[model samples]
Each structure stands twice: as C-alpha cells, then as structure tokens.
Target: MSPSRIMSRAIVLGFLFFLSAPLLSQSLTDEAATIDQLETRLKAADKEAVTAAMTVWVDRVRSKEAELVALVEKRSSVEGDEKSRLEEQIDALRTERDALADKAMVIVKAAKAQGVDGADANEAFLSGLSTHLDLKDPNALLTFALNWIKSPQGGIKWGLNILAFFAIIIGFKILSRIAGKVVAKTMKASRMQVSDLLRDFFINTVRKTVYFIGIMMALGQIGIDIGPLLAGIGVMGFVVGFALQGTLSNFASGIMILLYRPYDIGDVVSAAGATGKVTAMSLVSTTLTTPDNQIVVIPNSSIWGGVITNITGNDTRRVDLVFGIGYDDDIGLALRVLEDIVTKHPKVLESPAPVVQLHELADSSVNFVVRPWSKTSDYWTVYWDITKEVKERFDKEGLSIPYPQQDIHLHGLPTDAA
Candidate 1:
C-alpha cells in the first residue's frame, strides 16, 4: 500500500517488458527475412529464358501438329474411316496443346511487361491456378489426362452400365427359355396335331427376334454403332437370297404348310414314296418315321406338291371282305349267315346296317361281298373278324365255301386217242 512498494512493482514490470522487447524484435526480424528471401527468389527468374522456352514449346507443338496432320492424311488414303478418325483425334490434341501454349505465352508476356521475372512469376501463377483447379503439379497434359481420365461417377457408372448389359443378356436368355417352354406346354396341352418343327420354328423365331432387340439395346448402351451392322446384314441377306432360289422356295412351302395344316404330327400319310407317321415337320423338310422304325426326311415342297393319303382321318371306317360259296350250296342260306355274322360283331356300326351281297358269279364260286362299318380304331379287328366268322358260319350252316376249280372236258383228245 506504500508509494515505495508501488514504485518497486512498476520497476519489476518495466524490466519484464524490456526483456520481452528483444524477443518480439527478433520475431519481427525473422518474418522480414522470410519476406525478403521470398522476393529475392522471385526476382532471380530469367524472363528471357522463359520466353525462349515458351517459343520452343510453341514450335514443337506446331511441328507435332503438322506431322500428325500429314500422318492422318496418309492413313486416311490407305484406310478410310479409321484413318480419318485418328486424324481427327490428332487434330484435337494439337489444338488443345496449342491453346495451352498460347495461355503460357500470355502469362509470360504479362509477367515480363510487369517487370516481374517470367519463370518464377509464371511458376507461382501456375501453382496457384493448379491448386484452384485441383490439378496435379506435374504440368504435363499426359499426366493430367492419366490422373483425371475417369469421370466423377466413373466406377459406379461403369459398373452400372456393365451390370445393365449383363442383365439384358440374362433377361433375354430367360425370356427365350420361357418362350420355348410355353410353346412346348401349349402344344402339349392342345389336342391339335401340331408338328415339332412348327412349334420349334414359332418359338425360335420369337426368341431370336426378342434376343436380337435385346442385343441391339445392350450394344447401344455400350456405345456400339448398329447402323453399319444392320446395313451389312441387309446386304448379305440380299446376296444370299439371290444365290439360293430352291432354298427360298422350300422356305415358302414350309410356311405354307405351317399355315395350312393338311396333315398333322402322328398322322399316317403316304407321300413322296414314304408311308409312315409324321414325326417332324420343318421349314425345309418333313420327317417321317415308318413302322419299321426308319426315319425318312422329305422336302416340304415334295410333300406340298404330291398326293397325301391320310389313312386315319375319319372316326369310323368301312371294311370290305370277300368270300365265295359253291354254286351247289344254298345261296340264300349263305347270304343270311354272312349278314348275321357281321351284324353281331361288337365293333360294327348298327346305325347303317352291314351289307352282304352276292357280288359276282365266278368260274366255280358264287362271290359274296361282306361290307362292315366299324370304328377306325377297330378296323383291323372288324375286317379279320368278318372274314373269319363268315366262313365259319357258312360251314356250320352246311353251306360250302368254294375254291376256284375248272371243269375241263378232254373230249377231242380222248376220242382221238380211243
């Protein structure tokens, strides 16, 4: 609380302030030295040297541009589209490099005009600009391109594109498989006589069309040009069509067969020297499997143009059987027995009564015709049954079934011999 004590405190504070002043001054001196060092380094750059380097760079760019143009032109003459495309790329690169050189020259000129060293000023300016642009410090365009080649969404975008492409392929495959299954199932479910070839053709055509569209879409997504591909296919198709006239005719006939189903699968037909069940029918050929397990392939055109005998078309069929009786036997009794045997047959149709007729007078027998109407499925049984039963019944009734015999008189020869 005394004045002396207050004075002593003030002196201690003043001493401390004095000691701190040297430290502060040293700090200020260090900062000033750093600034001067920066200025000195900045002033040491040679503007003339940088200007010369810039001129050399510009000349190099121009020379490279000229060489690229010449090469592109030569390549373009040798190979049309690819060479032209390469030339375009070269021109773009040359233009970009030229612009970069021009920008560098401008920076150098501005620095020189401001009385600032070109190299150091330009270097500092480029460093600051690169930082702002978030570019690497190499200052090499190739390095820049390599470093920033990808887009902002590069990995995800590329993955998505690839995934989409695969997905489309898989989807098309699945669709094709499903379409085939559906076709098969539909054919199996329906009672119509559809050929395997017809079903396959329909399913395959639809699947191929769907797959073609899917492939085109996927290619477009991946940046492919389908215009040239389509044109090439069209030209190739025209050429092929011109060469194969018979094949085209066959194809047309096949289409006609599919549209107008004269005979279906499993139909027993006689055509093209082949009598068998229809196994497969295609655009080009029809396959028949004979009862002997032999496969025969016949052209669709042959089948379309030839006679087709569908043996199993109707639900019911008529069986004709011939039997003969001796002229000495009772003809009325024989006819009655034949008619009775056919009428009692289980498979014979009663709606139209079975017919028994005295067909013809043969050399030694009275020929009787037995006509029995039976289901198509029971044709063989009914035919065999009617023939067998008629003979047995006539025998039981004491009506003799006759064999061909000749009553020849050897009167002239015998009289001459006697």
Candidate 2:
C-alpha cells in the first residue's frame, strides 16, 4: 500500500531469492553426483558394490512413498493454504519416486546384462546366443559362424542346404532366360497386336516375377518361413511406397496410358510439355525421340495428368500456313495462288478441299490463312512443301509480303526573325 513499505518488502524478497538460488543449484549438483555414484556402483562387477546400490535404490523409493503417505494424511486434516501446499509436495515426491524407479530398473537391467545374458529359465532355449556382441572375445563371431555351418553331430546338412539354395537360384536363372526367349519367339510368330516395346516390357516383367518367386522358394528350402517373410515384405513395401510416392503415381499413370492407348510407339505426340515421337514406354516413364534425334524421358504421371496431343492419332491433319500480303496487292489473286498451291500438292487431301481466305487485317498487310488437309503420314511433308511453293508462286506473281517497317517523317524548323 504505502511506497516505503512496498520498497522494503521488495528488498526482502530479492534477498531471499538470492539466498535460495545457490541452495537450489547445490541441491541439483548433489543429486546428480549421487545418481552418478549409484550408476557406477550398479555397473561395477563387484558383488558387494552392486548389492549395496540395489539396497539403496529400494530404500530411496520406500522412503519417498512414506513421506508422500504422511503428506496425504496431513492434507486430509488441514484446510486452505496448508493443505494445498502439502498436496503439491506429495505430488512432487511421487513424481520423484517414479523417476527414481525408472532409473533403478535401467540399472537392474544393466546388472543382469553384465552378469548373464538370457538368464531367465524361460529363455534357456536361446541360451546366450541372443546376445548382441562379446567385447571380451573377438573370436566369438568366427566360432558362431562355424557352429552354424557345422552342427554338433558333424552332419553336413547345413552344407547341403547352402548348396541347394545356390542350385535353386541357378536353375531359376536358366529357366527365366529360356522363358524370355520362348516369349519373344512366340510373340514374333503370332503377330501380336501390342507394340514391340510393350511386348518386351511385359515379357521381362513376367520373367523377373518368376525369378522373385523362385528366390522365395529357395529361402523356404533352407528352413526359412516364407509366410513371415512375405508379411515383412508387405510392411517394407508400404514404407517404400510412401517414400517413392511420385514413382508409384507414375506407375499408376503408366497403367492408365497402356489401357487407354492415347499414343502408340512411333506416333508423334505433344504431351508433358514436350513434343516428340513415342519411342519406348514403361510402367513408370515414357521414352521419346525428338525430330532432331535427341532422347527425352518423361514421367507417365506428367503425361497422364495433362492434355495429350496425339499429332498422329488422327487419319489426317491440317497443314495451316499464314501469309501477310501488302494492302496494295490483289487479295483475290493471292487467294487463287494459294488454291493452286493446295491443289497441286499430291499429299493434300481432296475431301477437305483446302480452305484459303483473308483471315486477318493488319496495319500494313492483309493476312491470308491457308489450311490444307493431308494424311497424317504426309503432314510434315505437305506443310514444308506448301510453305515453299506458296513463297515461290507469290514472288512469280509480284505479290508483296509485308514486314514490320517504320516510315520516317522529317519536319524542318522555322528560322527566328531578328
């Protein structure tokens, strides 16, 4: 309330805090030192030290629990601040005891590990073989490996099992090779409707699948449980699928492409933001060859997720050409010349009857749009041929092709009168 009294109270509180800080720090330091000593004693090979550490650990928990019980009894009697304070102390003591118990359990496990591994009677079948490493004897590894290979009875069953495993693998290898050859020959003889790339991809997939199955069988021959192995593989596959989410999506998209047949091999297509001919395809990606012979690989996810422009999908394609003629040039005459060019080209389709008209008006020229339909195979040929023919015919007829130009306007300044 009063300024002087408040100042005095603040000074007293500050002095108390200063005094308590070092005591708290020292208390923590002492606790840490005690824990370290206890851990050291528990790890020591000496029987007396270890036994004494265990006794102390048990006593510490019992003492804390007794203190908590007394505080709890006091809490039932007292009211208000005293009871709240006693309850808080009880909770703190309980937490401390729980933490101490956890630490003691860790120490006990360490003690057991130091004395004897797999010491419980129920684990007699495992013996000490379940142990991780033996730092005392480095030769234990060689001994264990030898024991696995040669049993106590000196029978060569383990040796024969190893041989059988390799034999099964080699047999599968030979079978897979023979099966692949047979599939190739059969596909060629039967004139399969699928593309060569898809055929090959399918055959190889089957062969590899067979090989994987054979390997699993080989493991079973050596007394390994195929059931648990398959379960473990399923779990591993889930994790790997998550890790390779994009790749799996590509795989799914590839399946959709194979089923839909949007663009086959040797078909020119613009897909996944690239224009190229489909050369090879797989379950994850598509291989393309550009006109310049450069190879491009695109993920099937990108192709399937976007618009696929199959340039060669249709039976015929339109070769669109535009010519900008000067305004002074004869527009009708230009259209006649374009019609002649379209008619003369052998590749142009007659049914479509090539359209030629004034398409756009510009500042300096009238743009003529010429569209000539041609077979898909002759699309590029007709485009190039029509473009070249139109240029030559326009020049012969004295038609002006206007380009971007700026006319200069010169103005003279008047002289000033004196």
Candidate 3:
C-alpha cells in the first residue's frame, strides 16, 4: 500500500496497455482488409459466388457489431483515458461494420438483379442493420431516409406509383363525366320517355361505376392486390345490409318507384301524409317541397306504402266549383251566369265542355256545381278566375249567393217558462 509500490504497479499496467494497443490495431486492420477483400470478390463474382461471399461478409459484420457493443458497455464503466480509448476503438469498429453492411446490401441487390434468390441474406442484413441503427440520432435517420429514397424498391418506386395512381384517377374522373353526359344526351334524343329521377339515377350510377373501375385499376397499378379488397367489400356489404333492414326496404321501394313510374320529379304528389312537389328522389328517400316552401324528406318505404296521388301526372284536370244561390233567387238566372263565366275563361278546355247544373237544394239555398276542364298547369288559374267572375256576374244578374243561416223560433212554451 505504499506510494512506491502503487507507482510500480501503474508503470507495469501502462507497459502492458502499450503492448496490447498494437495488437488491437492489427486485429482491426485485419478485419478491415478481410471486408475489403470480400467486397472486391463480390463485385466480380457470379450469382453463386456472390451468395457465398455474402454469407462470409455477414458473419464478419455480426462479429464486429458484437465487439462494438461490448466496447461501448466497457467504456460506460470506465473514465478518462480508458473511456476515450475504448470510444475510439468502438468508432473504428462501427465504421467497419457499416461499410460491411453497405457491401452486403450491394451484393444482395446484385444477386437479385441476376435472378438469384437473396431473401435469406437480405433478411439477415436488415436484422443486423436494425440493431445498429440509432433511431434517436437525426443524422442517422436522415441518412437512412436518403438511402431508402435512392433504392430501387423504396421511395422512388412508390412515389412513381402514387403519381400514376392520381393520374389514372383524374383521367377516369374526366372520362366518367363525359360518359354521363353522353348517356344523358342519348336518353334525351331517344324515343323512350325516361323520368328525370330515373335518368339522374342512371347517370350517377354509370359515373360511379366508371370511377370505381378506375380506382381498382389504380390500386392494381400501385401493386395492391384488390382481390382481397373486393372480397372484404362483399363481406362488409352483407354485414351492413343485415344491420340496415329498414334502409333496405326503402331501397326496394325506390326500385319499385323507378320501375312503376308512379310519380316523376316536378309532379305535385300527396303521399305519406304530405302534399308537395316532388323535388328530388334517391334510392333511399324522396324529397318534397311543400306549397309554402317547406322541404320534407320522406323514406321511400312510406311513400310506396301509401296512396300516391300524382295531381299533375295527367295532361288535363277537372276543376269542380260549387256556388249556392239564395232560396228566393232565380235558379235559371244563376245557372246561366255560371255557364257564361266558365265559357268565357280562355284556359277552360272546349272539348271537355264545362257542365253547369243544379247539383243540390240545401236548407237555405240552391247549389249549382260548375265543372270546368283545363290543362293541368292552367287548372288553378281557371278555378280562381271562374270563382271571382261568378260572384261579379251573379250580382249583375240580380242573383244572390247565400251563406249558412239558421232561423231561430221561440215557442209560446218558452215564453210561459220565462
């Protein structure tokens, strides 16, 4: 434990360390030389020879990585000069391992280019590389990214495929629009009377189908196997259909509507307890805009389940109006006035002549039913004009229009009770 004895021990240790330095340096040099030799052979070697050389190179790289790891561990426990020296050794070993890995990757790529199966060798190289990669180091990550981008099967390939995918999709999107227009024009030019709802549905369906085909083609171009995708969609559809039975019923009703042509778009329809103009139709729901501009969306099932009165479906419609004259008024004079008012209306159809007759004699008045036929679009116009003119003409002809009136009679018994 004396100072002299400690100094002597330190001198001996220093001398041993000096002797081991050259031996360690020589070992590193030998390993580097072996790696260089293997790389040279790999460059000039055929497929089988490249494979053999790659196996040896991989084993050497693994051994060097293990040594580097041990050096790092040892350095963590030491301090000052010993830690610095171990760090230097670790850096050199790491450089050598990295170069060997680069060589192995090149060899595997070359073998693959020559149609040799380097799957096992490639797998081993990746496994070893993953172990050495410092994910936290920005420089390492950047280097890995740059390398992958430059590789044939990496960023370059996928980037090109992505560009191709978008290009195909856009091209088909334009084509679908053109196809839809063409179909629409054809339907219009042809003799068949296709309803607006059905036409819209067909155009949409065609456009969607064309776009879907394009999507499938783009997926295939991007190296995606869509066979499984379609299968998955079919299964998903089945599950969704089972869950949405009510929606399915609506869909079925929509199909029936399309086939049966009960009501077309723009028709004033009374169905599902709503009276409105048919504004839009889809496979699941029908949209109606009421007279007061309120929007209503009714399920197709409800529409098809009830009575659908398409008010404007026919070309012509009948407007029925009743006018009551006072009991004392002349019935003949009131009837003549009603006939004159209806016949003077230009919108009233001449073929289906207007009928003017005494329909009923009520408690206080004689009722005359005036029926006029006109184009469906002109029906309301005729009805309003006739009602207004009838009042004016009845006054001119000295005929009185009556309202509900009750005559109260008080009996003598009531006066006696009072």
Candidate 4:
C-alpha cells in the first residue's frame, strides 16, 4: 500500500473510534457507582464480588489512555472549522479521561486499605498507572486504616478469584474428559471407520473447546467484561493465523487426508514425490520409512495436493513380468513353462488364476507377458521368485532367449570407397 493510503486508513480507524467514544464515556457514572457497591460488598468477605468489581473498573481505566490517544489522532486529521470544533471535544474528553484515571487509582487504594493485597504496583489498573500521595503522617495512615477496617467495602477477593478460577478449570476438565470418552466409545462401536489420527483430533479439539468456553464463563462470573477480552482474542487470533498460514495449509490438508483415508499407517504409498511405507503422521506432516531404512518427512499439503498411489491398499496385487524368446522358439512351449511356474508359486493366488500369453511379436524375438495375482504382502516375493524360475527353466528346457544384434551387409559401397 502507498503511504497516503496507509495514512488514510489510520485516519479512518481513528475517526471510527472517536465517533464511538461518547457512548463509551456515557457509562462512566454508572460504572463508578457499580465499583463503590462492589467494594462495599467485598469488605464483608464477599471476595469474588470484589475481584469482579475491580476488574471491571480497572479495565475501563486501562482503556482510557487508548481512547484519549485515538481522539487526539482524530482531532489532528480535520482542518479549519472542523479541526477547531474537534479540538474543543478532544480537550473536554482529555479532562474527563484524566479524572477517570485518577479515580481508578483511588479505587485501588481503597481496595488495598481493605486488605486486598493484590492491587499494589500496576496490579490495579489505575493505581499502578497514576501517582498517589504518600501517607507519611501517622495520623492520616491510622485514620485511613480505621475507615477501611470498619467499612463494609474492603479487600480479600483474591482468594475468591482463585477458587472461582479452579472451579471453572476442574469442572470443564471433567466434562471434557467425559465428552471425549463418549465420542471414542461411539466411534469404536459404530460402523463408520475413522482412522485413529482423525478420531484423536476430534476428541482433543472438543475438549479444548470446552475448556475455552469454561474459562470465559468463569471470567464473566467474576464480574470481568468477557466481551472486550473476547474481541481482543479474536484480533490476536487473526494475526497469529496470518503469520502461520503455511502451517494452516498443512493442517487443512491433513484433515482432508484423514477424512478421505487416502493412505494409512503401515501402507506402502507413493505420495509427496516420495515412495515408502507410511510410518507416522500428524496434522503438519507425514513420516515414511523407505526400503533402505531412510526416514522421509513430507508436508501434508504436498501429499494431499498430488497424486497418492496406495500400493498395499488392496488385499491382493498383480505382478507383471515380461520375457522374450527367439522368433523360432515354440510359443506354446514357452507359454506352458510360464504357466507352470506361476501355478506352483506358493504366494500366487489361484482364484484370479495365472495368465501367460504371447503379448507382442518383435523383429528378433517374441514377447510373452506373465501376469499373476498374489496376496499384496507377498506380491514382490512371487514376482522375483517366478522371474528367476523362468530364466533357469528356459535354460534347462533349451528355449532360446533373444538379444539385439545386426548382420553386416557392406559389399560394393566399401569397395567403391577403397
């Protein structure tokens, strides 16, 4: 994007925020009143309510500076009459914003006086950000302490927040476990055949989803504004997703592969430009062990986007072997020898039967195609053993195996050159 366009976008964002600022500001008085009530409730050992109240008040205070900055940016974008008008609005809001920040510190101090030890430093939104006067006078400290001790509004909500946090976690944990087990058990008993990888993915995703919802609910129960937090989380997720686009692609491909069952562990597959037996798989990549015992890892996207040949997917496989014999050799005898060899092979299946045919006639030799069906596991064994048998049997039976050769026919041309 060009500089002007980027600047324009920033201006528009600022404008939108300023347009909404008034409505947000309108709730200030109500929020302050709510904080006071929650504080009063806290001193009576109503720990959870106090934490909830403080979180609300503090978050609003933290957000004030952000709103002020946005308003100033917007005010700078206008010109002449509009700029002058915005300047007034920005100034008024700045004053209000400062008062709110100071108010936040006061709330923190009151909470601290009540034995709420957690708000020291920046722990309490306003108190940490804004400066408070030191209570150097003994009499002043004693007076504040007495008022706080006697006041119904005081600290001690930390313990309640902890209890609420754990309750949410433990409850969600149990529910997530039960839901996962039920899904697993159902899948196991059902006719639908889902791979272990896919099954586990579903289970884990469900459990995590449950835990996330549980946490959000718990936060809401403690008086925190879950809405704004959720919005922030959504933005963070977008940024993370953009940064991890490659990983996301692999993840999507992995899900597709699992659902389609293009290949499975222990299956010999030719995928991702590599041929090997599938040894392991995850949402990101698949691992293979080659014949030479070399390990290869291929991204799931690479595998899913290309052709996948599952060599051992079926219960049986066909082994094709071609042999050549001299043109003068008896075709029937050569075929009979091949058929005999295939039938006696232990690995070859009889149901599909063995096939031997004079497939093609070449200039110097006749080609015979020997096709045999065998158990997938024993396909290579049958192919190698039968091919070796044919070579030896042809030698023993006196059947000639032809090779390419040429006859010299140079005569008169050679004499003329000489």
Candidate 5:
C-alpha cells in the first residue's frame, strides 16, 4: 500500500511480463516449426518418414498440453488484471495447441493411408482432447463422438467403404445375370449341335465365374488384399482336387460324355447294365428313369467306363421277331402271312422292305424270322401289333405252331428200375 512498495512491485511485474512475452512467442514459433516439418514429411509421402514425423509432432503437442495445464493452474492463484492477462495467454496457447492437433490428425490420416501404424498418434491426440475437454460431461462426450463420426478417418470413411463393397457385389450380380442371358442367346443362335445339358452347364458356369470376379473386386474395394486370397483359393483347390480323386474321375468322364454325346436327355439307352431313358445329367452323375418308373442315379465314371448302347440313337430301328411253325404247315403260306401283317402295320417304315423268311429248321418245326423297319419311336408299337396279328392269322389259316415234345421208349429203363 506504500508508494515505494507499489512502484517497486510494478517495476518487477513489468520485467516479468516482458520476459513471459518472448517465451510465449518462442513456444508458438517452435510449434509452427514442428507443424512445418510435419507438412514437409507428409509431402514426401513416405510411410516411414511420415510416421517418424507424426511421433515427433505428438510428443511436442503433449509437452505443449502440459504447459497449457500449468498455465490454467497458475491462473487459479492470480486475481485482477494479472488473472485476465493469464487468461488471454492461456486462450492463445490453446488456439496454438488446437492448430497442432489439427495438423497431427492430418498426419495420422496420411500415415494410415500409407499403411503406417498410427495408434500412438491417435492415442496422443485423443488423450490431449479428453484432457482439455472434460469427457465426464455428457455434452463433451457427445461432441467428441459427433466429431469422430464426421471425421474422414472415422465412421464416415468406414461406412463409405462398406456401402461401396455391397454396391459392387450387387452390381456384379446383375451383370452376371445379363452375361448368362447373352451366352444362352448366343448359343441358341449358333449352329453347333450342343446338347441341352451342355448348354445349361456352360451358361451356369459363365454366370458363376462372373459373379466370383465381382466378389473379388468388391473385396478389393473394401481394402482387402485379393492377391493373397486368390493364392489361398488356388492352394485350397489343389488340396481339394487331390482329396477328391474319384470325383475328379467322374467329372472327367462327364466331360467326355458331353463331348462325345454317347447319350442325351430323353434318349432310351442301355448303359452301365441298366436300361432307361436319360432324364438328367451332371458333372458327377447321370439320372435315368427306368421303364418301370424307377429313378436311378449312376455315377458318370461307371456309365462311361462300361458299354453304352443307345437303343434309340438312330431315327429308324429294326424289330426282329421269331415264329416257329409245325413241319406239317405250309411254309410259303406262313411267310406270306407274316409279311402281310408286318407291311400292313402303319408305324413300320416303307423304304426298307420287311423280311419274313424261313431262318432255321429243327426236328419238329421250322423257325421263321420276321424283321421290320420302323421309326425308333414306334418300334415297340409296330412289333406288338404285328406279332398279335400274326398269331391270329396263323390260327385262322390252319397253321400249326409247334412246341418241343419228347417220345418215350417203354422197354429200356423199366426193367432196371423194377
């Protein structure tokens, strides 16, 4: 309260304030220099350089934060204009620290993009922010969460990546369908005699292949390294192929069957000891519907390895029937009757003449072979009709159909048995 004391205090206070001004200015200049160095390293765009710079920048920011906290604590002990002056200095230092934080965040994002680990930098930044703003306050925590959600390296970037991944997958799925339709149309327009089963296989294969490529692209878009994924897939395929040797054999056999076309859908064929109509075919097995309506699934390997008799491969087939006549009946009349019955059948083919001739002569009867040509589809009908007609006509014409008969001698074995 004395003039001398007040004057002395003012002189000392002015000198202290003057000293603090240069120190604050120096601190700002040093922070600027650190930021500039970080920017230069970022421009280099090297992972190691940027990462090193980020570490240095984080340490500097942490040191500056400690200084800011000290100033805040020191302000609590002051009063009047000194308190106000300290408040201004704290505000300026906080602004400078915030600028450094912004710069650090930029470096962190860039480092992450360059495949550098930014965990330390991120933790340092968040720790500084949490210390500056009381995270115990709900509003502060909400603000922090909002800021993170809005940041480029946070929720927004990850959300965009996820959306892009799904978009790529969906787009590729549509493209695959389009590709399948195009393939089917092209195959239909072409003159190649491709079977239905083969055509379907090709179309499905094309669609699946296109879809798989889309999945790979989607994974890459989501920042996944597809190179290793593809390599792993190849290795797995090799392992699976080695394990499924029998399946591979069936697959190969199926391919051969497709190429050679030993039998096709709806073809009545005798293959692998089973006689049936082919209903479906796959790379592993062939499905058949037997004449009695039994469903049979035969492995392609078995079907291909054994004999394949395509009973209805050609457009026309020959129906052979044998009839035996008694030795007393007129052979010429029987042959004429057989020929008439076969020729009169509507389903029989006219170009190849029917044959009704004496084929063999036995002790009791003569055997006549009745051969007729007909459309493959109508072979059974023609055979059945002609055979029924032949029996009736033979009976009406007084023809004797003979069966095997044995004559017994009474004197030979009777005396020994008695």
Candidate 6:
C-alpha cells in the first residue's frame, strides 16, 4: 500500500509541476510582450515631441529671417536720399547681421558636432539670447546694439545714427559760435546800440531755429519722424509771439534806434521825461546817467518816438543876458559900458560879432539884450563874468536899475457934500 500510494503521489506531483511550468512560461511571455509594446510607444512619443520642437524652432528661424529681409529692403530703399550716409548705415547693419548669423551657425554646428542634442542646443541658444539682449544695464544695451549691428537688419547702422546725432549737436554749437562772433564784430565797428541789439537777437533766434532743424535731422537719421516735432515748434512759436507783442515792438524800436544815430553814448539828451547822458542801450531799454548822478532807464520806444533834445549836439553855443536899467538912465552911456564888458571878456568870440541892442521897454525898465557868442566850453565862464562886470559898472556910474511900480489913485467921495 505504501509503494503504490507513494508512486501515485509522485505522478500527481509531476503532472501538476508540468502544467504550472507552461502557464508560468506563457505569463512570462505576456509580460515581456507588454514591456516591449510600452517601450515602442515611448520611443514613438519621444520622436514626435522632437519633431514638434524642431518644427517650432524652424518656424522661429523663418520668422526672424522674414524680419531681417524686411529690414534689408528698408535699408536699400533709403539709399537714394542722403545716399552716402544711408549706404554707410546699410553696409554696417548688413555686416553686423552676417556676423551674428555666422557666429550662431558656428555655435549650432559645433554643438551638434560635439553630440549636443537638438533640444539642448536650442535651449542654450534661447537662454543665451535672453541673458544678452534686452537687459536693463547699459552694458546690456551696448551688447544688444552690437548684436543688432552685426545683423542683416542694420543694427550697426542704427548705433552709428546715434553717434551722428551728437555730431550734429556739435556742428550746431560751432555754427552758433561763428554766428555770434560775426554779429559781435559787426556791432563793435558801428558804435551803435540799436543795431547791435537787433543783430544779436536775430542771430540768437536763428541759431535756436537752426539747432532745432539739426535736431530733427539727427532724429530722422535714427529712424524717427520729425514732422510732428516741427509742427509743434511752429505752433509754440506763434503762441509765444502773441504773448510777447510788446517785446517785439521794443525790439523793432531798438533796430530803428541802431540804424538811425539820433543819439550816441555820452550824449546829453532830454527824452522820455528824463534828462541825462546816454550810457547803454539794449533791445528793451536805454540806460542813462543824469547830471545828478542818477542812473535812469528809458524804454526804446520813447527814445525812438519821443523828442530827443541833444544839448551837446553843437560845438559852440550862444550866451545871452538881459540887462535892464531905469528909463532916465542915459542910453549912450549904457551902450558904452556894455561894449567895454564884451571886449574885456576872453570867451567872447570876435568872429560872430557880439551885438547889444535896446531890445524892449517895459512899464518900469528899459531892457538891453546883450548877445555874446562863445565856445561851448566857455559858456558858463563868459556868462558869469559879463553879469558881474555889468553890475559893477552900473554901480560905479550911479546908474539906476528900475523896479516894477504900480500907480493907484484914491478917489474922494463924490462932491455929495458940496
């Protein structure tokens, strides 16, 4: 019983083991098949993702190329006007673009040659660009500018345009200096205030206007439109002119004063309610120093329009004195005394011939008008000497100088009493 039982158990165990081995082997094959299917699917997904990424990169490169081409067209179109300048700019930009492209191509090829994966190379390029371009620092701006200059878009040309702007500013400054010197020299030789002031004003205004044009030209070089800027300036100038009408009037008057030499420096003039020697004159006002040593400023309009009495215009002047005496005094004796006084005075001019006439007879006195000719320098001295000598002679001769007398009669109460 033990042998048969043991043999039956052995047969059952062998049958069970044989059946489980085929099942286990089949299960192992199924698991291997599933693993192979998953691996194949993963490989296909990787390939698709790579293709999509590469397509995106290629599209980006195409877009960039289109932009560069448009820039090139613009550069070419500008060649006709300011041809030399525009050509220089275009060439510089084209050189910059080529260099960048060549460098980028080299980097890509070298990376690829070194077995850098496509994704890695693209990522590196994008990261490098982000760090280098559009940074907030000046160095970043310069680097970005350099990159553009090397590009086909004429980035270098744009950079040079900025430099040209500074050069234009310098040129304008030089022009201003020259204009100023020219105006100054012209004024200095004229010995006039009005003309000098007007010339200066005109030159300054023109300088500012020309400088504005220079600015516009520079801006245009940098790809900016100057039309609006010019229009704005014109409108602003109109507004300013309207607001400063009085100022313009004075300026015009100043010009007239300069052109017409009515009064010069150090001329004594009575004008604009002021009597003084003209000192300095500008576009707006005339400066004067009065006899009392006071500084007075008068408007240009007053000088140009009002009466300007120049006291010192002539080199010689006349001094007249009225000598009056009593009607009873001897006229012949008076005339003789006056003649002596005139002959003795040193400042009396013999050429003009001094005349003493019995000019007027008043109610109380006979007036003798004594006319004496003298140089302006001797006017005061001769006048004083004649006056003093006349008094002395009249006193010595016992001749009387009369005073005004009013005669009045008192009427008695009518002969009513009679």
lDDT of 2 by residue, 128-155 (tens): 2122223343353444345434542123
Q: What are the per-model C-alpha RMSD values against the true structure?
A: 25.1, 22.8, 19.9, 16.9, 16.7, 28.9
Q: In model 3, state the lDDT of residue 239.
A: 99
Write candidate 4's Cα lDDT for 1-418 as tens digits: 8999999999999998776554333333245545555345344433333444455667776677676566666755666677556555544554455556555654555556656657675344453442121244344345445533443332235446667878987999899898889888988988988899899999898888888899898887676889899999999999999999999999999999999998899999999788999999998999999999999999999999999999999999999999999978888899889889989887888888878888998777899999999999998898889878999999999999989866778666434555
Candidate 1 on 179-209: residue-level lDDT in tens?
A: 7778778878888776666777878887888
lDDT of 2 at 300: 97
Give the Cα-based TM-score of candidate 6 against the true structure: 0.57
Residues 1-418, candidate 3: write the lDDT tens digits: 9999999999999999777655443333243455445455445455555556455556777788788788766766787777556655655566666667765665565566677676466756645563344455465456556655765456787899999999999999999999999999999998877677788988998999999999999999898989999999999999999999999999999988987889988999999999999999988999999999999999999999999999999999999999999999887878777888888889999978889999998988899899999999998899899988987888888888887898999776634555
- Where does candidate 3 clash, by residue pair? none
lDDT for residue 219 in candidate 5, whole number 0-100 = 92
User: Of the pair 3 and 6, which is ahead by lDDT?
Assistant: 3
Could you tell me how far off, in angstroms, the CA of residue 191 lies in candidate 1 after the best superposition? Answer: 12
Q: What is the full ranking by TM-score, best candidate first?
A: 4, 5, 6, 1, 3, 2
Q: How many pairs of residues collide in model 3? A: 0
Runs in model 5 deviating more than 4 A are 1-156, 327-329, 405-418
User: What overall lDDT goes with each candidate model?
Assistant: 0.68, 0.73, 0.79, 0.75, 0.80, 0.68
lDDT of 6 at 197: 50
Error of 1 at 403 (Å): 3.4
Pairs that clash in candidate 4 = 39-153, 40-153
What value does the lDDT take at residue 81 in candidate 2? 74
Off by over 4 Å in 4: 1-153, 156-162, 414-418
Cα lDDT for residue 40, model 5? 54
Give candidate 3's error at residue 124 in angstroms.
17
- TM-score between model 3 and native: 0.53
Q: Which run of 10 residues does model 6 get worst, by summed lDDT?
A: 128-137
Error of 3 at 241 (Å): 1.9
Q: Give me the overall lDDT of model 3.
A: 0.79
Query: On a 0 to 1 TM-score scale, where does candidate 4 land against the true structure?
Result: 0.66
